[model samples]
Target: MSWLGVQNLGSRKFTCGHCGNIVASSAGYTRNGSNQRIYICSHCGQPTHFDVNYQYPDIAPGNDVQHLPEDIEGLYKEARNCVAASSYTGSVLISRKLLMNIAVREGAEEGKPFIYYVTYLADKGYVPPNGRGWVDHIRKKGNEATHEIASMSKSDAEELIAFLEMLMKFIYEFPNKIPC
Candidate 1:
């Protein structure tokens, strides 16, 4: 790959798909016989390819929540990463598992069926008012991703992750802000 000493890709700020940090992109290069321009990440030194108007390894959505258990946090981050990496089904599956983990951490019994965790969370009010419907939707989407021929779409994963973010913030982050 010869670095053609010219920036075909204009200077721009980007979220490094590899590192997840926002950085002013390094110089862009075009290889011989290829139409795409490649720019290296300033933060991670990983290269991001630009073809027409698209990027390789699209930036993942979602951010870390405070006061979350290590395992749950890892799973949450992994789910977001999966979505960013085009693993929509995997993200949904991980989000499903995350619901169970959250329920157990919030005092629900372990080793129960998936629905048990959902019901437990809802019964105990961990799902908040009027949130049961979407909670059930998450479970249903997860089931489809797991058992059905239909794979999840990017929007589906994004929607689930968005809900999970809010739920976690409510159940874990916001509550912990009070005096002990």
Candidate 2:
């Protein structure tokens, strides 16, 4: 799996998966002819392994979503934790609820159908111009995640999370940045 750090030996500064800090490694090793290396964190004494192959553990928390309502913020963090725990489907399902929650927080009537929230966002000019496709993709994937008997891939979960970040920033962050 991919690990964050320089490719050289000796002390390397990498993100410690345990402490979530970028710290120097006290020690590390890579086998001969193997692109994988395991480094011990100086900060936490825990080991973080990096491979030039697949990405296994997504240890990093998802990007912060600024200005979200407290409950929605919690859901966003939970979805991120699902990825760290390798629970892709859970992340996707949570994103579905988040889509609705964001709408309700924006003043859409509660208890309406799921599609109503999505449409409400669009009709109210919340979804950015030409950004309807991203919203639709989240909707379609959320539906598939619910109806289909399949697990979501890491990519699927990550893509949706990225979209949510953008949508939230557009709605909450950017506006808050402007001088009132």
lDDT of 1 by residue, 60-122 (tens): 887779999898999999999998788999999999999989999989888988999889989
The TM-scores of all predictions, comma-separated, are 0.89, 0.78
RMSD (CA, angstroms), candidate 1? 2.2
Could you tell me the lDDT of residue 4 within candidate 2? 50
Residue 18 of model 2: what lDDT?
Answer: 65
The lDDT of each candidate is 0.87, 0.82
**Model 2 agreement with the true structure over 1-180: per-residue lDDT tens digits:** 334553447776676656677787657666666777777777887767777743235474568867888999999988887887789999999988998999999899999988898899999999999988888888989999999998898899999999888898999889998998
The global Cα lDDT (0 to 1) of model 2 is 0.82
Candidate with best TM-score: 1
Looking at model 1, which ten-residue stretch has the lowest summed lDDT?
1-10
**Segments in model 1 whose C-alpha atoms lie over 4 Å from true places:** 1-8
